[model samples]
Target: MAPIFSLFLVLITEFSLATAQQRNSNISLGSSLSPASSNSFWSSGSGQFAFGFYPNGDGFSIGIWYATIAPKTVIWTAKRDDPPFHRDSKLLLGNDGRLILQQGEDPEKTIAGGSQIGSSASMLDTGNFVLYNSRSEIIWQSFDAPTDTLLPGQKLRQFEEPNELFSSVSKDDHSTGKFRILMQEDGYLAQYPADSPNLVEYGYWDSGIKIAGNNVTLNLDDNGQLYLLNNSDNMKNLYDGGNVSDKLMYRMTLDADGIFKVYSYGLNRSDDDWKVEWSPNSVHKCDPKGVCGQNQYCILMNQEALDNVVWFNDPYSILSNTSRPDCEDECLKDYDCEVVLHKDDQCMKQRLPLKFGRQQNDPVITLVKVGGREFKKEKQSKVLIASVVVLIVAFTVLAISGVLIYKYRVKGYKKLLNSGNEELIEDVILRSFTYGELEQATNGFAEELGKGATGTVFKGLISNGKRVVAVKRLETVVAEGEREFRNEMKVIGRTHHKNLVKLLGYCNDRTNRLLVYEFISNGSLADVLFKSETKPRWEERVRIAVNVARGILYLHEECETQIIHRDIKPQNILLDERHCAKIADFGLSKLMNLNQTRTNTGVRGTRGYVAPEWHMNLPVTVKADVFSFGILFLEIICCRRSLDPDLAEAEVILVDWVFDCFDSHELDKLVQDEKVDKSKLERMVRLGIWCIQDDPSLRPSMKKVVLMLEGTVDIPTPPSPSSFLSSI
Candidate 1:
């Protein structure tokens, strides 16, 4: 009797806790919940859906999944690329209306944000997490952002032939997979290789709908029917499942096996839970468009015979080619290449025993001779041993040198103090902190903010909740890394403009190189300008443009040492609470004596925004930065990215399109924001055209640019910009 009573009590307690999760549907601002605590999730009113962390890899990913089963099926994830690094993680709704994910006592990352003040978050009974503004309007919702899975009532919009969705790495692995259902430029939705977007459009499963317009929606109904909603409000059935019990919930998912499927399931969770209702492609495992081994073909006997394939001990990565969008070029450019196995543009070069399969087909294989010699792998073990020995010796040397460097740095600072130069000492110490202090402030570096080629940034709180700062950790601390570190330090020490983000402090202890800066409530300019559903007002656009020009003007002139910002683009420009622009990321900035006009250097800036001189290898100057700013200026007015894929053939390049609009007397079409004053808008466009001229001699200086934007200088009739159409 005692044992029975105890079991009953345990079941009752678990039920009560689960019930509480549904009733308390709110996650308040500045607070976080973690799955490791057993109460980190909130359930829908009927307990049908739940939002929490799903454990995978070294850490867990924050996702919304079905809660009634043993193995949860994730419907959506906040950050597919950046997942929480620990079990003791929490999801926080910040005061600024951003959805932040943080690992236990670690740095925090902003996964999603609501662009409204006084907004609050609620996990709705319909499995939607919404951020509601003060007027009770939804500022942001989880439904607007979909991952690999799509639930009933959710819609995928195709305003401009949108292609967005990725597959899970494997049946058990939730990382990136090679398959995707994408919308091609030819008005079709098909399953293609995720890594290759520009290959000839081919897929095993396509919607087969040839529509006349781009405004359409792909949605699933409660009865397990997939339909397309055109510009009209009518639904056209694409795939029908006849009839299923209305009680069963259905979901469409892009699985790891490169198959898109719709499955039906219900509560109680039977052994064979998910019932497949619809599959566009054949159910055979080989029918799905999966990646295959390089230069290898299967006999296609049966599933059992699939295992009778060869593999290599040392398999390289997806041998990617930087010159082209697809992998074909990478295989051909390599010295040791013998065969290029290509499928949807994804290539695998075969040198050793072939690797990979479950890739849908025997790839379109192409073979080529390298130096007219055959390939062989021998003495591999000896090669690995020698590599390890060299690495160990190199690390030892770096460690010894690091210690000597640290002593000199500390000694030099002490000398300033001993010499009684209080100003110099104060300046150095004011922007200095021990590595441990930053580590503690960031809770063991748990939350990642953003990552770039050079370093990764994390969100941090200091002064006991008073200050929020962004902390950047460089990938390495040697050679190029050291140069970037000192360059930033020198540039930041001299400049203090209102449009420049202030550097709070820095950490340089041994191999660790970190920087701390004030956190602007609003994020990057690229973030605001590139959103598919939202656009900035004309007034805000002009303000941001003028303010950014002012910041650049200050760097070029008003400083004690003239600083040339070599990289000036939307991502490097940040916005503050007032929506004012601030130029950040000074790692690429160069200092010159007041009279120096230009200097020679290698290519540096991003692909789309780099100056034309980069291609010619001419002496780089401040005009290079001016050229980038001009491109960004055009992007702001048009409300389009520099790399837009939705334009007609004639308007393929943004700069070329602008010129076409000017020549055709279709300036009205060039200005998208209706509220913009036409004369001012045309003047702005003309200024942008002049700033991006091919001849550095023709492009206006930054000082004159500020005057032109302010309506102080007389505007000039701009000529056509030199043709520069290079792909990234």
Candidate 2:
């Protein structure tokens, strides 16, 4: 029995040792991975990081990401700018030592190519994926081709060619974004917009080390210290993270907003993760050039005396004879002028694509020219006499025509009566329903769906229950309600878009006015976003946001007559059975002719969603609707109300809290524990901020907003939107 026990123990020990060896073994040549395979990824020995297929959009992408993280964070990607590969694609390390990707019998694409051949690969614990030769020497490594992140023990070296780290387009997109950090040949590290020339004027940040003929490298140590090292072995500390605990992981990243930051996360904790440990503070918040695009200037707030001033470089034309007031008039009059700088009775005019704007202590008054319409004054006496004559002639003609039409209608009615048929008033454009028919359809207004400022909505079935409809019974039959009913009918009746609610017919009988619309089955967006037991998926919210934007775009630009949806909120958006969003509630909308751009009007939206221009008595335009949609967009992203008094004091106002989180690099607070596409989330947040700008000119048109939401255009960094709120 003792001999048998010894043999059993030996055999168990050998088996355990063999298993351990296999677990730690390097990936051999000819190994492959596919999305459908059970072994889809090659993980590091500690199972902290992996290299293989990752879910991207509706397909798969070859990348390296943290395997243990709750929301898997990708650090490196192959073919970063290419569209995601299909599910049938495969990644293979060929026997000849080439890493290749094959998609459905297509030609193999080389992922990592080099002169060295016949090697193995490994997904190292340092978050680096490496290919090694027969001598165990690294031939190619992902660390050498960094994307947007630098893990601990990684180095960015400036050798024969300058090393650059481009920011990702968004949290979800690994493609190169707008900004990049370059380790210059002159031993100075600088940040610039990716599209701009790598010149000093384009650089937004620099390490200030300009020594030439020295090898420079940026390194991140395991202790959370980031530093620059030169050939003399001299180290310049960029950020000292104060020796982070072993239970924490650190990463240095150039964020999508063009802010370089060092982040830390606790390994043991799940919530409240990704804290910003270090970010540059030596420069002003708005020091980054190209943040605002051509013809735009950035406003920096909460600055010292010297920082309050704004300056533009290289004005195309300077007029020494112009006065300060004349400077503004000059820019406004000249269609080519974009901005004007005036000082000591001299006006300097800048043309389109203003460049190199900065803030400094100076006495120059900068006036920016935005778009506006000019109204020519007419002679009052001539206009009044002409109007009176036209009215007298029109009244006489209308009276004659009215009598003739009435006599013909009366004769026709008598003929119909003689024929035993009821007289019917037919409208070619809109079907006119009688009050009795609507009442019968709604079963005497028995089932109430909702109540709004104008009227109450009732759910009903018509055509013997074959068709469902919503009937909005107007409460005020007098001047105000009558005007709203007519306006809504005229505005929505002619507009046609999939995202806009369909107006079936209307009832305008005696003192009753009702609007009949096709029934939306899913309810209001507010109910789905705020009141539902389970929050809608992120994809759904994004789709709803785009749908709402398209609806507003159609109202603002695509329709025959431009319309301003004075009230655009979650409650005004209805969803159908497939969760497709459609914009409703047009009672407060305003119409504008093709020649008109803006109008002065009273505030007409919900309190929390109203644009700042309403309170300031400024001219309202389609931008007002844009501002309201901005508020609604934020609500959709965060799945919270714009104003919630039940939350903490700092978070009570959703816009303020969202901006604070965005400013502080703590956007995780906006969607705690929820898995979201970080890139799209940030893009939406930036767009919302831009839409809510205090200055109406800063708000983008709904057309551009749709383009940005659809990822067809880039969204610029936004300024503080709380200026009006703070003043109030």
Model 2 vs. true fold: TM: 0.46
Location of the lowest summed lDDT over 10 successive residues in candidate 2: 397-406
For candidate 2, give the lDDT of residue 223. 71
The C-alpha lDDT values of all candidates are 0.65, 0.73
Q: What TM-score against the true fold does each predicted structure earn?
A: 0.46, 0.46
Instruction: Give the alpha carbon lDDT tens digit for every residue of 304-359 in model 2.
Output: 23222343355657787787667777777777676566676777776544443444
Runs in model 1 with CA error above 4 Å? 1-23, 104-106, 160-163, 184-186, 201-204, 242-246, 268-272, 282-290, 293-337, 340-372, 375-728
Per-residue lDDT of candidate 1, residues 184-262 (tens digit):
3333456666654222222445665634344667777787788777676766676884456557788888877677888
**Residue 269 lDDT (model 1):** 52
| Candidate 2 positional error at 65, Å | 1.2
Quote the lDDT for 688 in model 1. 88
